[model samples]
Target: MPVLVNSHPSPPLHIDMTPPKPIIAVVTGTGAQGRAVSRAFHDTGKWHVRVLTRNPAGKVAQAFQKEGMEIVKANFEDKASLVKAFEGAYAVYSNTVPPWHQSYTNKLGEYEQGVLQADAAKQCNVQLILFGTLPYVGPEFMGLGGVELYDAKARTNDYITSLGLPAVYISMPAFIDNVHSWPLVKAIDGGAKLEFVGYVVKPDKPMVFLWVERDLGPSVLAIAESFRTFGRPLAEHPLNHNVLPVGSWRGTWGQVSDEIEKQTGIPTIHNVLPSVDQRWHRELTKVFHYQNTHGLFPTDNFPTKVFSSLGVQYGTVEEFVRTKIAPMFRKS
Candidate 1:
């Protein structure tokens, strides 16, 4: 049985007051994507961000503390600890990754962690939640193997919906920064060798898309704001559960290979499936092949349009990739 932390007597509703500093509790806020998004939310100064981590005093937690973020120790595997972490939060930007020690390809650990977070948040009276999820057309049209990241997220979505809480779920196609998954990055100075598996059987030319991470934050914020207006639209009122694909301008893998050479001056090579055998690399290759075959393209808007309508101004792929990611290569 889970311990009750802050149960309310009334029906679940977002109590909009003078907009007192928004408290956003982010689970696993120390991770790459979580840290970046939390920093963006904190920079606004209107948000009071609290991070839930197993090691609250570790390097990542310390870094966030220096930035003035509240650190709370909560292990999702422990229900009581998670309950305590969600005690007083207005909204939560939630993410959970598999344990580093785990060797299994299917990330059931991350999936279970998210389920615990959602259950704990519901008990704690959180008004809104901004959740990260993989693409799914319900359970019927699942993509990307429908296991590990995707299946876990789909389960979490079901859990949150059953809680009857107002939630905004964002489905990001793929990260532009996933280039780090390549093994060649280990040998190269500023460049990484890119590879894709699976056949690209399409009328359109074969291509690969890389998503820039910096563009993710503003779009996430936009989704968060949309949750504020959630439930105003009836369930039958064509609720917008939109999917936003984030990548640099759509072009051939050769174009991306050329851009890498131009930007880093390091040779970029694209290898076919047989040449690439790394587990993570193969997973990414599958995603690229699927999206290309499906003719997926990056949107022109910084923040996706549906989210933008909810008042989020998104950043562009070139701007983020050039500023945030490009500097890392220079530093390397």
Candidate 2:
């Protein structure tokens, strides 16, 4: 049986007084992406990772304990809990989850949590922060109207910028790993047709991919190291945020289908260029329609030189899919 722990009374907090060892606290450390980020920092052997969890005895919390990560119970809604969790840390990696279905409300919670953590960091004299955000240009994609999710995050981004803190915001691209939600992963196993609605120029448009949530750890660690160097410098263009479109390639729907066939030894077909009304039954069709129709596709395939200069080498979507994602399917 696994066990969860809460090491609150331990004062003069254990800090690795050596090169490369930084004390960092990650919010919602039990979450998919959060866990990955925590693991990355721990595996580097340079930082002592503290995880924030509301219930530090659940399955996920126990898993982190096994990894030797310090588990702290921190409720996002409770400022005291947050303050307690962030005590004596050198940095805070912010990521929080609130009640689902309330897009606007949940996003507000995320923003508030960040501000609260920053306040705690200020009090503790932490050196840096690493935050995750989406690529949004304010009302740039508002013409479609149903992108409340994007809007909420954009609002949060704006708030973080106003704070004069040493922070690095990783504007992550669309999780190419989101392909799992589509029929592609299933198609990889056997007979299934890949479908897409709307006009997509074949083999020309660059499609970017992000790994599944699990593999986001090392990437987040790299970003944390970057923030340690960049410090709390205000971004020249704050509201207008961008992402590095990694694991992105220009290919058509046909090409994607062909690739699937090649990989799985199966025949893959697509409906291709259907009437707007004929698009596939996507649960988030409204969001996708709005983004695609307005040509506001979100991807991060920027030149590697920018990241290389920062000493961050992120994984490619292909590598993430083949090495990380495909394995999930095998397990299932």
Candidate 3:
């Protein structure tokens, strides 16, 4: 016996060698989609959540900070600032609003900021990069007039892919809240009845709808979990991590109305408008027609397997309208 160790080798020193959790920095993580993404990652308790915003002093930022997130002040136009914010982060989740949405910039600035963000992430050596993008409807020949919103993001997507960076492109759909934002509610019979209009010209056209605030978190969380399980975290270019579209319900607009009535027992009619009467009708009309033909995703979109295990509240159009929409109107 070569001096057999006594007393169980000093009890292994009883040290706390547990490693720190990975960090996830969310860029533009304040709006509907970003807010949901930030909260989803933060709630896991496995991730150190950090959010980047130009205004860290805003009410939304304050609210997010109160919810236990690290808020970093960063501007989309400043690549250096973004890199600083993204430093030490393992993953970056980013979404950019249409510059026109808030009347913030004269020229379409999505492409510019998109490039800056991508460059920053690339420079920072982030392991996973997720961007919110929309697909374009064409082969550069259809000449869709109101497609600038989609086109700007499409350009960004191309740039990111060309960089061969590990990225996830989140293709989002029309928000269920659009009816409220665009306001298609017309008081029928001078308040005797209320009609909520849908964007489809035909009753059978399939449209994809998602209440982003509720569903995006689970959608992104699904991807994050997948990355942890089987995704290529070490590989240089994880091309397999490509476009992931998220939607809650895809059906006729009539189905949406029926669900509202069925769940809330509210009397209402599903009004299908021939054409949208909003200021940007030309583009909106084209968008409707694009869906009428190509559909949002050609081959059976949004597989349920991705998010089935999140164990969170899943929202559907019917439930959304019943709970959120029905309250907007009083008894007829």
Best by TM-score: 3
> What TM-score goes with each of the models?
0.70, 0.69, 0.81
Tell me the tens digit of each residue's lDDT in model 3 across 8-102: 56555677788777788887778677788888888888888888887899898999899888999987777788889989887888766665454
- The residue pairs that clash in candidate 3, if any, are none
lDDT scores in order? 0.59, 0.56, 0.71
When sorted by TM-score, best at the front, the candidate numbers are 3, 1, 2
Q: Could you give candidate 1's per-residue lDDT for residues 169-269 as a string of tens digits?
A: 66555454544433222224334532222233232454334343455666666555555445564232233333344433445544444454456545555
lDDT tens digits, residue span 106-147, model 2: 433545656776677666766666666544544455444434
lDDT winner: 3
Give one clash count per candidate, in the order shown. Answer: 3, 12, 0
Error (Å) of candidate 2 at residue 215 is: 6.1
Runs with alpha carbons beyond 4 Å of true place in candidate 2:
1-20, 96-109, 137-142, 181-184, 187-205, 212-215, 227-257, 270-286, 293-303, 324-332
- lDDT of model 2 at position 145: 46
Native-referenced Cα lDDT, model 3: 0.71
Model 1: residue 99 alpha-carbon error in angstroms: 5.6
